[model samples]
Target: MKICAIRAFTPLTAALGLTLLLLSFGPASSSTGWLLAQDEAPMRGDKKVLTIDDYAKWRSVGQTSISPDGRWVTYAYSRREVDDSLFIKEIDGGDPAVVVRGSNPEFSKDSRWVAYYINPPEQEDGGGRGMREAGTMPTDLHA
Candidate 1:
């Protein structure tokens, strides 16, 4: 009787184990089917992976400021191997003003204008290089 019972359960146990193994390695949808909608599945074909070339062309926004009247927004846009710019845009509508090589923008007290620093063009003279290591000061320092 014991041998017969063991023989009867051997095939059933094997089938159950096989089923569990297949479920463990099945598609991700099988596990997350309840959380995701049927129409909201990932569009894998439309996506493109980012590469190193994409990073080089990327632009980023820096510090931002709002006008006193809350009518305008100013922010710095910077990119690699290109001059940075300050963008001043009207809050409600219209095109934004672009200031090349500008940074640290501040709106006027009356909100009539914006003030910012225009960075000097980069020179190949290696200005400010080795200031700490060589203990040399730049002669053209501005207050």
Candidate 2:
């Protein structure tokens, strides 16, 4: 049990350590998680596969919208921009072409209609004249 007797590691041990270190750093996926690894490691064992609904985009930066059937999802690919307002990706195929570009997008309750706004929010504002010709503001000061 002499602490001083523990000499340096052998070359074989050093090689084994290096190999393991490289392997762990290369690619690995947890058995239960939404993240995917770069490698094709069958680490899931007997666990079931997952879909887009199981994960959420950046909580603060982006928003998530799930379809009624939970088979599809739409989220902001990047910042809500004029060219790419929102993107709709299937849980299975989930191709990029399924994206909807415009101001505000709307999905039907039954996951039927997927409409993208044609105009901006500012333009859509109902800021027209009132029903009757109203006068100045309520000038009756706090009584």
lDDT of each: 0.51, 0.37
Question: Where does model 2 exceed 4 Å of error?
Answer: 1-61, 79-83, 98-101, 118-143
lDDT for position 76 in model 2: 46
- Name the top lDDT candidate: 1
TM-score attained by model 2:
0.33
lDDT of 1 by residue, 55-138 (tens): 454555555655556566666766677778776766555556777777767666666666677776565685632211111111
Q: CA shift at 143, candidate 2, in angstroms?
A: 67
RMSD to true structure for each model, in Å: 25.9, 24.3
129: Cα error in model 2, Å: 22
Model 1 Cα shift for residue 12 (angstroms)? 66
Worst 10 residues of 2 by lDDT: 134-143
